[model samples]
Target: MAREITGFSNPLVKRVRSLREKKLRKREGLFLAEGLRILTEARELGVLPEMIFLASGADPHPLASALINAVEAAGGDVIFTTPDILGKMSGKDNAQTLIGVYRDRLTPLPALDRARAPIWFVAQAMRDPGNLGTLMRIGDAVGAGGVILVDDCVDPFSVEAVRASMGAIFTQTIAHASWDEFLAWLRAGPGQLIGTSLNTDQDYQAPAYVPPAFLLIGNEARGLPAGYEAACDLLVKIPMLGRADSLNASVAGAVMAYEVLNQLRRTGDQGTAPQAPE
Candidate 1:
């Protein structure tokens, strides 16, 4: 049975709401993920929230009910609250009935199994949580190993990012490191680093992208620093036939990731050098 709470002044409610703050989240080592679909993905992915807040007397989603059972079975808490309290915690006037407080899953770069998948997505200094989240969604779509966040990127655990991910937050592995740290780690392994840039004349479609390829997109405003671009094993540019000078960082990343996924999927291609298999 779930505990029922009616007050907006509840301490646990405050704690769940505080996760919206980066400092509080870092201090707590937990983050907030909301919605039946997102929480369902988390449960299916073997991630159980430390606590779940459900609107009392509201009709429960079938999956949401399953989540509550799994959570309770795992010794997690389920709190039933008024809809207003749920709204207060989620900062949404029309908040979903279900919200979850999950442990942050960002891993260290060295902990990543680069060989776990054929492609991986990398982002540098991306400030927008929405863009960062969308890139993670793309990582999921391409069957990439994970999303490697380089440098001072947005917190992947932010509610905005998690919401933007539309549950891809649970589907994709996430890692973060500085440029130097990520580059050094990549160099120590068999991965290929492909960067998107305006300085490069090479076409995006022209490369025989290697398996375990790391597809990197630079910061939204300035893009990858000069030293970073020069460090890439190959740099390719998407042609802009329209008046737009460049693509949105996440959009560019999606285009690059799918192409890489296509290439690597065509053959168990591994380290094969040709663009296409005979």
Candidate 2:
């Protein structure tokens, strides 16, 4: 059903607005994604938000119409509101005309399909939402299975992270697990865990990456812990040509991810080399 909302006093408005907070999002099991383009991407990818808020006076576009039709077809609710109320819901004065409230669907570590794609990105103890979003974008770029967060990290579904993902949040699979859980799951599968580290003497480009390579990126300022680095199947380093000690976490991840992606694509990823016939 469609309803027109004239006031910001509605509990739904406040409820969507509070999704920007971690605690509120945790309790509600919902997250807010604002912007017509992002929601359209979701729609095209078959993800319809449970509830949609549209600006009552906004100009119509074909994509927007498509999104509305798709949402309604999926038995989703559509609420028409003023731009001001829309802004309140988005925590922005110049918010987009469209906003979506989606239920958070977290992929548990055990449920992750190891062979969904050739590349997978893993982040540990990451705190920055923008960095987290960039990681998701990288995963989407390389056609990765997903981006997995190891240990405590930023909430990927947060408004900032989702906005920064620029719609890749819907394209890329997002999952979470503790260090122990992730290690056990990866070991039980046919995947290689590769970590980006400064302590390694191996250049990032020198190694042959296995398919389903799990690219591990550490905290922004701290890199990977010594123990975590030791657990990796391989450790490689991006050389520093300038005065900077290292690249940014997301930048480093892109470099490593692309190198492995190119390798896998070029070699056709024959898996581990077979032992020579006896």
Number of the top-ranking candidate, with lDDT as the measure: 1
lDDT of 1 by residue, 115-138 (tens): 777778888999999998888888
Poorest lDDT segment (10 consecutive residues) of candidate 2:
269-278
Q: Where does candidate 2 stray beyond 4 Å?
A: 270-278
Local distance difference test scores for all models: 0.86, 0.85
- Root-mean-square deviation per candidate: 3.2, 4.7
Q: Where's the lowest-lDDT run of ten residues in candidate 1?
A: 269-278
Q: What does candidate 2 score on TM?
A: 0.94
True lDDT of residue 57, candidate 1 = 83
* lDDT for predicted candidate 2 compared with the true structure: 0.85
Distance (Å) between predicted and true CA of 241, model 1? 0.3
Candidate 2 residue lDDT tens string, 5-108: 98879988888888889999999898888888899988888899999998877566888888878888899998888888988887779665699999886887
Count of steric clashes across candidates, in order = 0, 0
